[model samples]
Target: MASKTSAISASLLVAGALAAPSASPADNDGRRARGEAALARITGAEGRTVVESIRRTSPELGDWIVDFAYGDVFSRPGVALCTRELATVAALTALGNAQPQLKVHVEGALNVGCKPDEIVEIIMQMAVYAGFPSALNGIAAAREVFEKKGVRTTAMEAAQPVAPAR
Candidate 1:
């Protein structure tokens, strides 16, 4: 376990560009503060922005996300936030149909220090156990995320190569 974690930690250092996560002031103020901090560390700016919009339209859901998901669950010290987000990416990939949520968590995984290659490797491994279809979808989603985050991929570059011989 220690070796595995060390390997992952080493690889996560290669995370691609991602929006910085910011902690919003917890309205509840006590545990809220800690949770918000954890949330920011994991989800960063993207999570805050999306939650703010949710708060405007559905206060209950937004509150639940901040108070429960970020606050209570993520605040726990059993696992590192970096570990948590990676696990999330793996689970989402296994589900095979949660591309929307997978996309966000992939970014979150990066925000929490998961490298682009690590994310791809994680999903790629799932292909064998989770079957080609789910793995294929997971790869597609990860590719979209890499593109969105401006991480250059060989295929993407090939698709939009620089013009020459003008």
Candidate 2:
């Protein structure tokens, strides 16, 4: 049963990621500009901060996140942002080992209009398939995410550009 659900989830993710319009060299600049803007709109200010931190830690990863994940995958037109985040939250919960990422998506879910109870029920439903431990951990992570909204990812502080002397 769990395997079936996992397969279904995987299929949905793949389906959601179907190719978008091709990007030309000339269009790359425009697409990227639009991607960045869309990323900002969906993720909100806190997400931008985390993206900056991610960029500092891993330039390639950060680019893929903003460019591919948020820019391309997320900006895909078929699904609305709320639905997308719900899928993300469900997938993370089903994995039973993605608490940290779950927290972020849970917050993203809220940013995109999912209410707290809705999120609670989402994870609560996972308790059966994923087991109590995974659900507990996910709930805990969600609590922490709600308590504190911003991130200071590893090396982000160190990588911060220092201000010029006055």
Candidate 3:
């Protein structure tokens, strides 16, 4: 069941990605510009902080993050920003070794209008493929991000009381 869902998702992502118009060589500057805007849109003010931190170590990587990740991939018209952020959150969670980046995308997920419960569900869903350990870490990351953003998780949502069986 999970494999089928994953396969369908992968197919959709590939099809949508292929549908995006390719950037031309002359679009280098344009790509950078679009990337900067996309990064700002997705990550808000933290985008600059992320870039600056990366620049302190590898300036070119920073440029690539903006120009390639944000500019070229993110700016593509196939997927909505919120959907992309959710997908990113899922991928990072599945990787299980990128807690910091996962946290960033968790925040990005919220910024792009993914509900706290929705984000939690996505991470929890990853457990099926990424294992409980990865899912647990992803939940921890999501919890921290939710705390910082002051959003409530599904764990914190109120549930209706159930009557005892007679």
Encode model 1's per-residue lDDT on 54-73: one tens digit a residue.
Answer: 98999878878888888888
lDDT of 2 by residue, 99-155 (tens): 767877888887887766677777778898888887888777776776685533233
User: If scored against the real structure, what TM-score would every candidate get?
Assistant: 0.68, 0.65, 0.77
Q: lDDT by residue for model 3 over 1-166, one digit each (tens)?
A: 9999999999999999999997753277698789889888888888789898998999888988988899889999989988899899999999999998999889988888888888888899999999999999999999998888888865676856679999
Itemize residue pairs with steric clashes in candidate 3: 35-71
Give RMSD to native, each candidate: 16.9, 15.4, 14.0
The alpha-carbon lDDT assigned to residue 162 of candidate 2 equals 86
**Which portions of model 2 show Cα errors greater than 4 Å?**
1-29, 148-166
The segments of candidate 1 whose C-alpha lies over 4 angstroms from its true place after superposition are: 1-29, 152-166
- How far residue 82's Cα lies from its native spot in candidate 3, in Å, is 1.1
* Most TM-score-accurate candidate: 3
lDDT of 3 at 17: 91
Kindly report which residue stretches of model 3 are placed more than 4 angstroms away from their true locations once superposed.
1-29, 159-166
lDDT of each: 0.80, 0.75, 0.89
* Winner on TM-score (1 vs 2): 1
